[model samples]
Target: MLKDFKAFIMRGNVVDMAVGVVIGASFGGIVKSLVDDVLMPPIGLLLGRVDFSNLYLILREGTAPGPYAALAEAKKAGAVTLNLGLFANTVINFIIVALAIFLVVRAVNRLQAMQKSKEPEAAPSTRECPFCASTISIKAVRCPQCTSALAE
Candidate 1:
C-alpha cells in the first residue's frame, strides 16, 4: 500500500497537476490585483472617480448610521449590504483568467498539431513484386499476380 501510494504521487500527471495548481493560485492573485488595483482605478477615474470597490447597496443600516463612506466602513459597522463593485471586479478577473487559459490551450493544441505533422509516417506495409510489378504484402513468399516463385 505504501509503495502504491508513492507510485501514484510520483506519476507524471499528478506532478504536473500539482504544479499547475500552484501556478493557477499565483495567477489568481495576480489577476485579482490587476482588477482591483490597476484596472478599476483607471476605470473609476474615467467614470468620474467612482470607486468600484466601495459600490454597494445597504439592505440594513449598521450600528453607526445610514450613510457609509466605503464598503469597509459599512462592514465595520455590521451593515447588511450587497457588494456590487467587488462582484464586478471578480467577474472581470474571471474573464481575464478564462481568456488567458483559452489562449494557452489553443496555442498548445496548435503546437501539438504542428509536431504531429512533422513526425514521419509509419513505414509502408506492402511492397511491389519484382516479377509481376504488382503490389503485395511484404511477407509474401510468392507472387500472387503472376504466380511466380519469390526468393527468400
Candidate 2:
C-alpha cells in the first residue's frame, strides 16, 4: 500500500498539478495586488476621493460612538459592519484573475492550433499503374492484373 501510494504521488500528472496549484496561488496574489494597488486607486480617485476599502455599513453601532471613521476602527470597537469596500476589491481581483486566465488559455489554444497546422499531412498511398492504368499501392513492385513492373 505504501509503495502504491508512493507510485501515485510520483506520477508526472500529479506532480504537474501540484506545481500548477502553487503557481496559480502565487499568480492570484499578484493579480489581486495589481487590481487593488494599481487599478482601483485611480478609478476610485476619478469617482471621488472616496476610499473603497473604508466603504461599509454598520449593522450595530460600536461602543465608542455613533459615527465610525473607518472599517478597521469600527471592527476594533467590535461593531457588526457589512464591509462593501473589501467585497468590491475582491470582485475586482476575481475579474482580473479570470481575464488573465482567459488570455493564457486563448494563447495556449492558438499555439496548439499553430502546431497542428505545421504538421505534415500523410500523402495518398495508392496510385494509378503507368502501363496498365490500374489503381495500385505505391509500395507494390509489380501490377497484380497486368504483371507490369512498377516504377520506384
Candidate 3:
C-alpha cells in the first residue's frame, strides 16, 4: 500500500499538477494585490475619492453605534453588514486572473499550431488499383492482382 502510494505521488503528472496548484495560488495572491492596491484606488479616486473597501450597507446596528465607518469597524462592533466593496475587489481579482489564464492558453494554442504547420506532411504509402479496385503500393506501375498497366 505504501509502495503504491509512493508510486502515485512520484508520477510526472501528479508532480506537475502540484507545481501548477502552488503557482496558481501565488498568482491568485498577486492578482488580489493588484486589484486591491493598484486598480481599485484609482477608480475610487475617480469616483470622488470614495474608498471602495469601506463601501458597505449596514443591515443592523452594532452594539457600539448606528454608524460604522468601515467594514472592519462594523465587524468589530458585531454589526450585520453587506461588504459591497470587498465583493467588487474580489470580482476584479477574478477577472484579471481569468484574462491572464485565457491569454496563456491562447499563446500555447498558437505555438502548437505553428509547430504543426512547420512539420512536413507524410508522403502517401499506398494507392488503389484502377483496374481491380484493390489496395496496392504507390510505387507499383502495374496492378499485381489484375495484371493491368497503370498510368504514372
**Which model scores highest in lDDT?**
1
Q: Write the per-residue lDDT of candidate 1 for residues 11-44, one digit (tens) a residue.
A: 9999999999999999999999999999999999
- lDDT string for model 2 (1-152, tens) is 99999999999999999999999999988988887799888988998977888989999987877588888999998899999989999998988888989999999999999999999999999999999899999899999979998879
Q: Write the per-residue lDDT of candidate 3 for residues 13-71, one digit (tens) a residue.
A: 99999999999999999999899899999999999998989999999978999677778
Q: How far is 63's C-alpha from truth in model 3 (Å)? A: 2.6
Considering summed lDDT, which 10 consecutive residues are worst modelled in model 1? 143-152
Runs of candidate 3 with Cα error greater than 4 angstroms are: 139-152
Compared with the true structure, model 3 gives a TM-score of: 0.85
Model 2 regions lying over 4 Å from their true place: 123-152
CA lDDT, every model vs. true structure: 0.95, 0.91, 0.93
Scored by lDDT, model 2 comes in at 0.91
- Rank the models by lDDT, top first: 1, 3, 2
- Which residue pairs in candidate 1 have backbone atoms (N, alpha carbon, C) closer than 3 angstroms, thus clashing? none
Best by TM-score: 3
* Cα error, candidate 2, residue 99 (Å): 0.6
